[model samples]
Target: MENNRAALILAADNSPLQVGPGPDQSSPAADEVVIKVAAVAINPSEWKMKEFSYIPLKYPHVLGSDVAGTVVKVGEEVKRFKAGDRVIGHCLGLVYGGAKHGGFQNFTTLREAVTAPIPDAASFQDAVVLPLGISTAAAGLFDDLKLQLPSANVNDDKPRDEAVLVWGAASSMGSIAVQLAVAAGYSVITTASAKNQDYARALTGGKHIAAFDYQSPSVVGDIVDHIRSAKGVKLVGAYDCVGFESSTRACAEVLHELNGGGVLPSVLVPPEASSLPAGIKAHIVNAAAPGMVAGSPGAAVWREYVPRALANGSLRMRPEPEIVGTGLDRIEEALNLHKAGVSAKKLVVLL
Candidate 1:
């Protein structure tokens, strides 16, 4: 066993994360793998949980989710992985409560089921940006909504033209949503700040996407007009990454108007219960639901789809991380930047 330092939150309702030394590292379980963490990314859940005290807090809890690292040790029964493998995965921090130090520490552990080999073409930083977004997007697009992918033939042509709208397209989650939707043979339309339109376009393969300022009054109208121009919207589906009232209402309105009958999947709290339009379903995506954790059926679905997509390059990693911090001391600052909203890139910390 080796001792390692980590950052922890000793109390709930605290804005700052406390950095301090904690327990020594122990050997991995027979089914688990020990990782020498190379980089970690911050997500909104980290701060939201802290601010709202969303999850029960055990004193000296570690907070983080996204991790990319090299395998240093593997349990006796582990077969699919070995030491020296580079990997990235979504940490089940929320499900495991806040006690685990997550990816913020120099060393961490996870079951092989929750992780996969990083694509050889992608860097540790780029790969770290994927697990959460890719998992959530894969779950929503393939598992929840049952969207279909194109066949092997290049000219098969099986409805790769249906329009799907992605609200908050510039967000890490939203960016993944747009890319996955397009890869699944659906045309994508998304909303974001005017400045991020180029970034969104690059991710979407330059498809028929429109970026509108979230602050604009005509945002909904602009989206509606785009959908209308795409011809009759029979198979309209929307993915809302921003859960704010305005974005949700606007997406709800556009989907309702365009499809006249379809479901919209949202990552945030569902749209106001009573205000939902007829023939429209609002499916809430709880990415961390226990069922999606390692060894669960939902995890099976993700493990199946994400690896194939990633390995074949159907999905591309996002831009290189813009900011990289070192150790727990830099975690609080990274969380603050994420809370204030990131631009077109992600911030990561090297553990």
Candidate 2:
């Protein structure tokens, strides 16, 4: 890659993300495509990567996961994309290749499986919200939970007898999981504050079993009771999107009480197993997990479903994007703002 600039750290010492020349990149792998990044959404991990040296990155590293941009180069084996196509990619820079693969730069490389074309009607900022959220949720539902995959066609059209509980449905990852579960024909049970209950339900197109108030002390019982009240619906599993100890406990408790014990996939690292209820299993969802295999649930979502879903309005841009500023220079400010805490909005930097 040439003529690329990036918001990267000089050292992983709680350093600022400074704009500078990008790391040099060699030719892309056969399954990879190069993107001219136009917009990127920040994640908690991005800030933590510096503040805590959470990942122990190489010096002058770049950290980004959510990306939306135009294709500039394609590998010979890449069949779905070419130069000039608009797309969104789940860049694995911090987790995979150090600086070269990061999305903070104007140019980033993405594997075909984790990349998808965005409809022309959609803006980069709007589409940028999908990558990490979609990847993390897909890893939880389709990979970890091994739930059925979503579709743009008639696949899994019949509703199943099982239901899934999504804790903190108003959050970014939870919202995506809610829609994906409902789209896969499993009724979703979710939790949000009283004010956002309707918003969470709306994420499922009103197909969710219920959106309980998470602030209520009885939320766990409420979710369990609601799931039990459904005539034939079984509580198959739960995803703690918030991943806090309390929410994790709530989900595991629901699973143990309702399903007698089940697997729980969480967006954050779960509490220690010793502290959890007996028979409850927990999995930490890695956004990069889905790209590990061919024809994976993530593959189906990004390659087979998302494009058509976005085009037809079946999928929505949830926890809508709030533009932090234009250009890579603002990524530090965006990361700091995100670290301080943002509710119901994904911070974005446009280039």
Candidate 3:
């Protein structure tokens, strides 16, 4: 029997999204595969875009970024993946030059470039949580900042001791950034709420991580003091997972304190810092804009780095997501929870 189920759709105004069953599944394109989505992860962009309408949202647009599912069908030209392959990928959502549909449905279609086989060890819930954040973190730390990976030869005498601070370490992207940074041989100092401190340390392989409550007024000073006290804190860099004004400003202050004589990389737009300390640079992480397919750089990164990392175990699945509801009917509640703020955990809806 044909699968007919409701999908969460965004109206033209980008207002509250609605869940409704609209159409039957469409055949895959030559380079596409049809996936029976098992889980979908929410991202801040889903709500942020509502205000800007930056991406063209055709009426009834689907808004979701991360997905893990089984491939039920594939088009003639789809080679890297086949039917029955379990996979996870960034949905790219319909608004941002993405596929015709997104992951927030019982089924969605994706091109070969953005899809990758999920690890045998990962569950659908955990697998879905990694792609979007891990991909961005990899792109930011490795590609944008041009940081080198550690060599196998221990005596190679490379500067593997330099530290990189990950602001907002408990966030999904922040959490992944810690792991990727540690794997690359940089000591990681991250900030998270007091409750998530211990969990943050385990995720990053237990390095020089420190958790600070963003709610505390002294958070900025705490980060700066931590970096300054570290031995040989030269050539420092940072990744700001939270892009709010305060988070960016706090990171900026710490970077200024470090004064490592190089640019500090940020995943979000950096705050304007006049009178910045000497030898500090700030670059916004446009992870999706590089090596993009048909002028989409984000897609290119997803295609290139995501697969190898998964295959090599350089990236691992996050905590298993709590799957809330199945199909489109559950979207409104999910969005409401996202708007209200997640409690240091990811909320996913199965489709």
Which has the greatest TM-score? 2
If the candidates were sorted by their TM-score against the true structure, best first, what order would they fall in? 2, 1, 3
Error of 3 at 277 (Å): 6.3
lDDT tens digits by residue: candidate 2, 168-281: 887889878888888888888888888887788778567644789988999888888888788999987799999899999999999999878888898888999889899988
Pairs in steric clash, model 2: none
Predict model 1's lDDT versus the native.
0.71
Off by over 4 Å in 3: 1-10, 21-31, 75-77, 94-99, 149-159, 208-218, 260-267, 272-284, 290-314
- For 221-309, candidate 1 gives per-residue lDDT tens digits of 87777667766544457777777767777777887787775666777777665787776677777676423444343365345655666
Off by over 4 Å in 2: 154-158
lDDT of 3 at 125: 79
Q: Which clashing pairs does model 3 show? A: 288-297, 288-298, 289-297, 289-298, 290-297, 292-296, 292-297
- Model 2 local distance difference test score: 0.85
Task: Specify the highest-lDDT model's number.
Answer: 2
lDDT to native, each model: 0.71, 0.85, 0.67
lDDT head-to-head 1 vs 2, winner = 2
Per-residue lDDT tens digits for candidate 3, residues 212-296, read 6777888877777766677666435777788776776666677766664456667667667554455556667764442233544
User: Ten residues in a row with the worst lDDT in model 1?
Assistant: 150-159
